[model samples]
Target: MFTGIVEEIGTVEAVEPGTDANGVVTDARLRVRGPLVTSDARPGDSIAVSGVCLTVTDLPGDGTFTADVMPETLRRTALGELGTGGRVNLERALAVGGRYGGHVVQGHVDGVGTVLSRTPGPRWDEVEIGLDPALARYVAEKGSITVSGVSLTVTRVGDDSFGVSLIPTTLAVTTLGSLAPGARVNLEVDVLAKYTERLLATAGSAGTAR
Candidate 1:
């Protein structure tokens, strides 16, 4: 599990697409340079690469680590659009008894969202992002949401979009500060909300059957 706390901004070193004998793309391998995350990273450690939990496959000992991205991950996330030299938010898995800075984050991207607008304030920027209809129910005003590995609170929510306020620290530290309108980002809603929904649905079904 992850805490949606971005440790550092890593650059994509390389992207190698895997193709089968029939020339069909099967998967992609990524080499990312994150000095802090790789400081103690082992071959089997889990790392969150821009909100996607990827297993560390190799450590080239040059502050770079490799992870294989399956086809399903590419189809569900913005990672497929990443190219060499692209900057991505990176975080190591939460250690036991560590300070819980952000909310519960699974490092699992639920869907991709687009930047719709950005309203700049003197101290912070209010950014609105388009949300998928299926995931809309999980978002609530003041609720927590993870956008490209940065945990942020929902300031305002609409039927098709949600807004978040990014402070100066967030703007200077993570990839969200550089996002422009129409840019795509990986999104993960609060997992507690999902579990609550599931429990409520099961209860309703039981009542109906009784």
Candidate 2:
């Protein structure tokens, strides 16, 4: 599991085809090349690459690592479209004693969202994203949402969209600063909300049957 806290901004070095014959799955070699993240990384360790939980397949020296992207993961997340030199948010798995700086995140992208607008103010910027209809119910005002592996609070929510405010520190340290309107981003809604909704739905059905 992850905490949706971005540690570094990594770059894609290479992308090769995986064992899948349909050209759907891919193997990505990323170059974060940072000591704090790569020093103890081993095969099968989970790392959040731009909000997607990818297992390390190989750890090449010089700060580089490799992970395989499955076909379903490619279709459900935004990692499949990455090209060489593309920048991505990176975070290692949260340790047992690590501070919970952000909300709980699975590093699993539920779906992809598109940037709808960016309103810049004197001290902060408000980013709005159009989310998928199926995931819309999980978003709420003041709720937590992970976008591109960065945990952010939902400033506002609409029928099919949500907004997040970004401070200067967030802009400087993560890949969100470079996002423009219409750009695609990986989105993971709060897991608690999803579970709550399921329980409520089941209870409502049970009540109606009585």
Candidate 3:
């Protein structure tokens, strides 16, 4: 599990084939090895690579690690569009006694959203993302949402979009600063809201059956 807090901005160094002889172009395989992320890493350790929870498959020397990207993961989220030299938000799993600065984030991206607008202001910038209709219900004004592994509060919600305020610190530390309109981003809504919705729906159905 993660806290939706970005630890570092890492770059995709290389992408290689996952197989040798039975070489079929499946999903895009990648090896995103970066410093500060693999300082104490090992195999099976969970790391949020741009809001996607990927396990460490291999650990090469000099702070380098590998993880596989399947076709389903590629199509479901925005990790497929990454190429060599692309910057990505990275965060390690929450430790047992670590401070929970951000909300609970499973690092499982629910869907991909498109960047609608990024308006720069005097103090901060307001970023609007065109979210999916299905996920729109979970987003509310002042609710927390993880965009590309960075936890941000929704300042406003429209019919199919939501806005977030980004301070100068956030802009300098995360990949969101470089995002342009129409770029795709991974989104993970608040998990607790989904459970609440399910319970309410189930109770309503049960009551009507009487």
Candidate 4:
């Protein structure tokens, strides 16, 4: 589990693809260079890399760690799109007794969204993301959403777009700082909203059946 609060912005050191005996592509091994996260990392631990929870396979003891990316994970998240030296938002798993600064995050990417617009400010910038119409129902104004592993509030929502404000700190610390229009990003909607919608739908179905 994570809180969606980015601890540090890490760099993608390497993405090595593995192949099967038949020469078919199997999976990819990712090595991320994060001085802060790797300082305390260990094998078998979980790290949220760009909003995808990956198990730490090798610490390497060099301010970098390795994680295996399966084919299914590659298909479902934006991590596969990364290349060497790409910027990525990183957050360590929520520790016991830690303050919950951001909303609940599972490090599971629900889908991919594209940047639509960016309105810059002296101190902050408002970003609009074009999401799939199906995900609009899960987004609400003033609610929280995870974008590329950064926790932010939705300032507005539309049929296929939502807006978020990035403060100066966020711009300096995370990949969102350099996000441009048309760039793809990983998106995870509020889990509470999804659960509420599910319960309401189930109740409505039971009422209709009675």
Q: Which structure among the candidates has the greatest lDDT?
A: 1
Q: Which model, 1 or 4, shows the larger lDDT?
A: 1
Q: Which stretches of candidate 1 lie over 4 Å from their true place?
A: none
| Candidate 3: segments with Cα more than 4 A from true spot | 17-25
| CA shift of 194, model 1, Å | 0.6
Candidate 1, run of 10 with poorest lDDT: 18-27
Error of 2 at 68 (Å): 0.3
**Ranked by TM-score, top first:** 1, 4, 3, 2
Local distance difference test values of all predictions, in order: 0.96, 0.87, 0.88, 0.92
Query: Which residue pairs in model 4 clash with each other?
Result: none
RMSD in angstroms, all models? 0.8, 1.9, 2.0, 1.4
Query: Which candidate, 1 or 4, would have the higher TM-score against the true structure?
Result: 1
Candidate number of the best TM-score: 1
Worst window of 10 by summed lDDT in candidate 4: 72-81
Angstrom error of the Cα, residue 159, model 4: value is 0.5
| Tens digits of lDDT, candidate 4, 1-210 | 999889998899999988989987668999999989988888999999998999999998889989999988888788888999998888889989998999999988888999999999989999999998998889999999999999999999999999999999899999999999999999999999989999999999999999
Q: Write model 1 residue lDDT over 128-149, tens digit each, in one string.
A: 9998988989999999999999
TM-score of 3: 0.94
Clashes of 1: 0
User: Number of clashes in every candidate structure?
Assistant: 0, 1, 0, 0
lDDT of 3 by residue, 1-210 (tens): 999888898888887645436785566656785788899898999989999999888888767678888777877898877889988999999999999998989988889999999999997898999988889999989999999999899999987999999989789999998899999999999999899999999999999998
